[model samples]
Target: MKFLKILEKRKSIREYKSKKLSDSHFDLIDSLSNNLPNAVKNQGLEVNIFKDGSIISEKLDGIIGYHGIMIKAPHYLLIFGDENEVAYKMTGYLGEWLVLKLTKEDIGTCWIDVGANDRLIKEKLNLVSHKSVLGIIALGYPKSDARVSSIYAENDDKLISENRKGYPNTDIEYKDNIVSRRKPIEDIVFLSKWGNKITAEELDTRNYDEVFYYMRLAPSWTNRQPWKFILDGTKIILYIESSEQENNNYELIESGIAMLYFEVAMHGQGIPGYWNLEKLEDEKKYGAPDNYYYIGYYTF
Candidate 1:
């Protein structure tokens, strides 16, 4: 439940206060970046968080982000790694973990959508790294008018689905509500197999109601929640829906974000587990469809 409070209050802050992040906050970020979770190292993904985002904000303004619109923030972090599927997923995992950690410190964070023009983007940003830019995240103290608890806040209870138990005592009532929309638990969680939907009672009986409830709150590309979970006995298989068209890199990143959210939610409930993304060869063996890409699984 430690992150539930943050998850409730966590919203993408596009418009930020002009003031830069404090020195202590900067140090905290440096520490976290250097001491990333072991999974990041194991995946061979390198995280390069460049401070002084003004230069990036200025240079790649019209090149990156949707509709060539970039968010101006005091700080920004970019993930660079080999051009691979799991690279994109782990990028999502690493970026979202930092976002949540920053959220815990009341530092606002927003993942800016990067276009598929990777080479052009690297050229515009004056990057030397041969790795692809998995994602970009803007960080800053949100403007008072733009703060979640102020003008743009959503009702906290509504964040965890209608009357969810994750944040039971939260009663943050704010005007100018920005409704937080999430797909229902049954919509994303499959029972025993892929596409085998489960009911609310089923989730409760399997002790997964809270995990899927809060996991649905994870941020995704254009709010497209592309990931799903299959509860296979003692294990949970993850799948991300792939578009028919090319450039489905963002979908893999969304898979990573969902993975992180599920892990955090499970960890909160005293369930410790890590995703075994090495099960790529088991996709056909598991009887998954072609459209749904197998990402990984968690065995507790």
Candidate 2:
């Protein structure tokens, strides 16, 4: 449970202290960014760190027409992808890992999904033609008055539901008391097949309690938690819960975030493993219900 303390304290802090980050902080962050796992490992996504905000402010002005979501942090990490589904997922995978690493260092971060001038950011970073900005991560120290209005209470033992509204519009303002809602375990975890609910007693992971718990706490867009897992021995099969909207691009990114969280939790306990996305065709042969689309698998 090395990350347990960090997972408990890692809140998306919108308000930040204006002090600059030291060179050591940037060096540690850069090291983590260089070493962490990504969707495409060797040739994965690229991350750029900006210690200044002048250009960022100009580029982010018209995103939602209000410019109210601007977070005045000393540093911002811009994540670039290859303008493809895998790259987008890699953004989430590597980005979330970097965020956790920062959290472990006692730094605060906020995942900015909207209100970004992605085009301007790409140009500022001088990215190649095929690459684009996936998203940005705001980094700084939390303000003295910053407090998280978490959905889970200190002593509340009840499993919560994942009934949240869709993504917010660009005009959305930052709130101090942000709620961190999570879906009940039965709603996301399956036994052997899709939709097969399992209780904590049936998880079968005798030593993986905290790892699975941290996986449930992974953040997602609009707090949708739009991913599910099917535990089969030491392998965890992933699925992007079907959405009738358009495509599952963003959902795939969220799934990648969840997978990285699981892997990080395992590594915190000295366990070793790697990801395997080559099972897409084989997973389809399993005939998972239409509600669940097979993504890939992570094996130990």
Candidate 3:
């Protein structure tokens, strides 16, 4: 199956086999490294492919003071970005592209955010001031009997806190379900304006099934899925639902990843488009609440 089909087939596999990947697999991965799409064109985003995850894994475990959440794999990918608006978005854009490339190679991956907070890990990647590890991906073949006994979201704020001793609310064990649940399209999507709902059937008739289908599946912190879409004719605007608490940059990164998925799925279905991140002039005219700020628009 193509990468588009693999979108739905892909699940976050926590258990991975210890065997090393073949040379041909790494060759394919290396070929795609230069071809990754950058939200900011020509921006220097670097990725480190660790064939043996031991060095970085040990550092992350030592710094975070926890060993349970970090997944062990034969290889890992770290996307380093300079702290800025464009770099944050590009981090997600390039990182997810690599994730999809690995998926196409039949390699399993799980996004590991907590691992990015380690000072030693960042130093090992040669990240200087203002540049840091944006995200990490655990890469390897999934074990034949791999199953996630439970799923939990790490508190992004606490991950980097100087006072943090361990991650909270991450050890709760649930049932043996392996697949993560996604919110239905109707709950996360709107027609022309916010709070104006429409069913997936409505979108399928308009030839938007592929775009919205994949966008809805984009991963987010804690599965908060803190995003909403506004479909106005041929334009699709992205928004993050408003929050009162201290804001984190991870949401913007996740939105960028979702935009990439939407674009790739469109291309997979023979549609062409690019994202426009410029804030809309009359964004409030669309009935979006004060809490829903514009992220960008997908123009076909």
Better of 1 and 3 by lDDT: 1
**Model 3 RMSD to the real structure?**
4.9
Question: Any residue pairs clashing in model 2, and if so which?
Answer: none
- RMSD to the hidden true structure, all candidates: 7.9, 7.1, 4.9
Best by lDDT: 1
TM-score each candidate: 0.84, 0.77, 0.80
List ranges where model 2 is wrong by over 4 Å.
38-40, 64-68, 114-117, 123-130, 147-180, 204-206, 242-248, 269-271, 285-291
Candidate 1: Cα lDDT at 266:
91
lDDT digits (tens) for residues 1-300 of candidate 2: 266556555666555778877789989988876766644566457788888754564556435111233544678887776666566667778877777778887787877653234566556545565557776777888778654322111111121221112112222222432223566677777766766777777654545656676777777655567778887777778787766656455576677787787777777766788777665545654457787777678788
TM-score head-to-head 2 vs 3, winner? 3
| Per-residue C-alpha lDDT of model 3 across residues 25-119, encoded as one tens digit per residue | 88877777756664555767777788877766665654532334456677888776676666777777787777777777778877775434646
TM-score of 3: 0.80
Candidate 3 overall lDDT versus native: 0.69
Computed on alpha carbons, the lDDT of every model, listed in order, comes to: 0.74, 0.64, 0.69
lDDT by residue for model 1 (247-266), tens: 77778878888888898889
Q: Judged by lDDT against the true structure, how good is candidate 1?
A: 0.74
